[model samples]
Target: MTDAELDLVFKALADPTRRRIIERLDDHPGQTLFEVCAATLAEDGSGLSRQTISQHLDILERAGLVRTARKGRTKIHTADLSPLRLVAGCWLGRFIQED
Candidate 1:
């Protein structure tokens, strides 16, 4: 990934909500919007709306961290780990040694 592309991925991960969303997808791939909305609800049952979650999904999709497939009336999201692995192998991996 280019610098700008990496920047985009980092930016998408910068948000707390987005981070939780990613975590949700990582644990349970192919989750519908409603499922994600329910899983992220706070203790008091107040959390992000469907619209807000959708927006975050869009940003994540654009950053190549996630992908969506429409099945009937629902959309299933799957985590794409390639970009993150790339960042680890090509960028962050340089910082550590096998020692």
Candidate 2:
């Protein structure tokens, strides 16, 4: 990924809420807005509003971290870890020492 794209991905993951959303979708693929909100509340009791989660999802989408599709009238979200893995391999992986 280009530096700008990498920047976007890093920026998207910089937020804890965004990271949680990524984890949620990673564990359970294809979730709606309401379902995400419910699951997050059930897990942490944060009671975050649907709007807040929606906003976070938007950032994830822009960063290529989340993929969204329309299933009938409902919009579903899924985590896309390709960018994250690319960043890790290109950047973070360099620091690892081979045994």
TM-scores vs. true structure, each candidate: 0.85, 0.91
Model 2: colliding residue pairs: none
List candidate 2 stretches off by more than 4 Å.
97-99
Q: Which pairs clash (backbone N, Cα, C closer than 3 Å) in model 1?
A: none
Tens digit of per-residue lDDT, candidate 1, span 1-99: 689988978899899888888887998999988888888885326567789988999999999999999989888998887888887887778786455
Candidate 2 residue lDDT tens string, 1-99: 689988999999999989999999999999999999999899878989889999999999999999999999999999999998899888767786354
Give the range of the ten consecutive residues with the poorest summed lDDT in model 2. Answer: 90-99
Highest TM-score scorer: 2
